[model samples]
Target chain A: MILTNIESVPGLRTVEHMGLVSGSTVRSKHVGRDLMAGLKNIFGGELKGYTELLNEAREEAIARMVKQAEALGANAVVNVRFSTSAVAAGAAELYAYGTAVRVE
Target chain B: MADIIVFIVLVACGYFIGGHRERSHYRSIFAREAATLELTLLSGKAIDPAWQVAQAALVTGVCVISVDYFKSVAAGLRNLVGGRVSAYESLIDRARREALLRMKAQAAALGGKVVVINVRLETSSISGMKADGRSGQVASVEVIAYGTALALA
Candidate 1:
């Protein structure tokens, strides 16, 4: 599937609006990693653990959003956007949203 | 001698109570499976696609519980004694499964076959600043699942 953050897909045209679609998740990782991350910001380099954690979270949220679009009989999701919020002491929420539409 | 005995007793009591509290917390959140059957039930109709699509907005929360710093040190010491680190493995597995289930429900609602490509996950610290001028941090992580829907021409 062609997944782009751009509102318009290169070749596909949105033929009909299938309405809004989204996927969201709240997650938490190791506290120790967080402390190391703060220290790493000053030192500068890769923080492997947190990086992996965030990457997984993003993938999961987007997958669900796309799934929602598909269920609506939408060929594509356009104007895709992501947002994050603090949900709990050790958790954060990630949300992906887009316009679900039939493309031609 | 009496003061030392009292200190040791107090520490033991604290450990016992803390362990019980942790167990209860896990039982409350980790063991319970969120209702997923609702998605299949709702999808029984070809009704308003928009409303059906909106159902994907359901917020899923996945908590990745790891060993506390003290616990990690203890575990490390236990590892030296040839003990298993089963708790760490269990925590990671549970977090991954929870995220997957949430995505699956969203996908099922969208009538999508699977979540594929360009998947991303993000994590942030939720805690405020600490007295040591360091940020008191709580971790929040998110998983983004996305894919394409195919139509038979």
Candidate 2:
């Protein structure tokens, strides 16, 4: 399967537009990670734990989106976009959406 | 008071340590940006038809950066005056640049000369908040950069 954020994939012509597919996931920080983040907050720097957690969540969201595209007989997802929102105090929702297409 | 003393110490530590880290991060960003200058990045949705493309794939980079105690305090003060919060500006700038560089590195891994098109950047604040939402603190900001990378033979 191929994924591209542009309208079409390079060197491949989109044969059919399979409408839109989307996936989302919500994650909350565990206590251990939160404690470490609190300490890191005092000094200001990259939150590696949070970064890795969110990265995994985002990838899972994308995978779910790809699964939907595959179900619709699409070979690729195009014009992909991502959005994130804080659902609760320490929980965040990551959403991935795109247009599924058959490219040849 | 002990609380006041702790606040001062935290602020001092944040100032000295955070400042040093920011400088080093900037140095690294500058050097890596120069090293990856060969990879072209574009926000336009379409690619030039003249170039022969070998492969195309999606590439993404993400960064979660937090503001130090000193900068957050400075920003809070700036908020009262309704002026530009310069303290937070550098944080956002660094996050965006770092995310872009990571995206470039991913594209370079695809082999051959790569041009990333349709680049999109999104920023969101991911800080814990109280149930009532009144105590929502700006602990960190997340920046995500994504695009389609086309490798040319």
Candidate 3:
């Protein structure tokens, strides 16, 4: 399916709107990763592990959202948005939402 | 006594190492931004109708940058006085620019002239709270930049 974070896909026309679809997931860092991050905090740099973890989680969330759109018989998802929240000390929740539509 | 000594050492290390990392990151960001100057990044949803579009797809970039011990401690002191916390300011700035740069790189990889539309940035603090809901010194900040990349025809 075509995905765009705009009102409509470029070079295509929206033929139908399929309401809204959303997916979310919460992830927590493992103890080892948390310990390493604690040390990295002292020295200061990119938390590569956490970055990868969050990115993977976001992709999964997007995939689930896409699945929902597909089930609704939508050909594209538009006006997509992502949000991240700290669910707990080491846990983070990533949410992806968009308007599903049929494009021609 | 020993704990105080370790605290001092950590602060010293944080000062030196964190400063170096920030400087280098800025330098790299500048270079990459210049390299990708031809690619367009926009926040508005409207796209110009004149240009022929070949393809459009979702693109995203994420960055997680940590604050040094020294800056967090310095910010804590600023909290008491109620002034702008400049140390955290630079941290967030770096994270944002880095995330955008990575997004631009992805746009460039789409194999043609491209413009990113409806770009949005989301920033959140991570590892900053405990199970008891008590917030600690912000260990790191996360920034995600996403948009629709339209390859020109």
i-RMSD values for every candidate model: 12.6, 2.2, 2.1
Which segments of model 3 are wrong by more than 4 Å?
B129-134
For candidate 2, the per-residue lDDT at B10 reads: 97
Q: After superposition, how far is residue B83 of candidate 3 from its true place, in Å?
A: 1.4
Least well predicted 10-residue stretch by lDDT in candidate 2 chain B = B129-138
Tens-place lDDT digits, model 3, residues B1-153? 999999999999999998898899999999998988999999888879797999999999999998888888898899899889999899889999999998998888987899999899987555765444356544788889999999998
Score residue B8 of candidate 2 by CA lDDT.
100
What tens-digit string does per-residue lDDT give for candidate 2 at B1-153?
A: 999999999999899998888899999999999999999999988778798989999999988888889997898788788888888899989999999999999999999889999899976445653334243544777788999999997
Q: What is the lDDT of candidate 3?
A: 0.87
lDDT per model, in order? 0.49, 0.86, 0.87
lDDT sort, best first:
3, 2, 1
TM-score of each: 0.41, 0.94, 0.94
Give the C-alpha miss distance for residue B62 in model 1, angstroms: 20
The model with the greatest DockQ is 3
Better of 1 and 3 by TM-score: 3
Q: What does candidate 2 score in Cα RMSD to the true structure? A: 2.1
Candidate 1: regions farther than 4 A off? A31-44, B1-134, B138-153
DockQ score of the complex predicted as candidate 1: 0.10
- Candidate 1: docking tier: incorrect
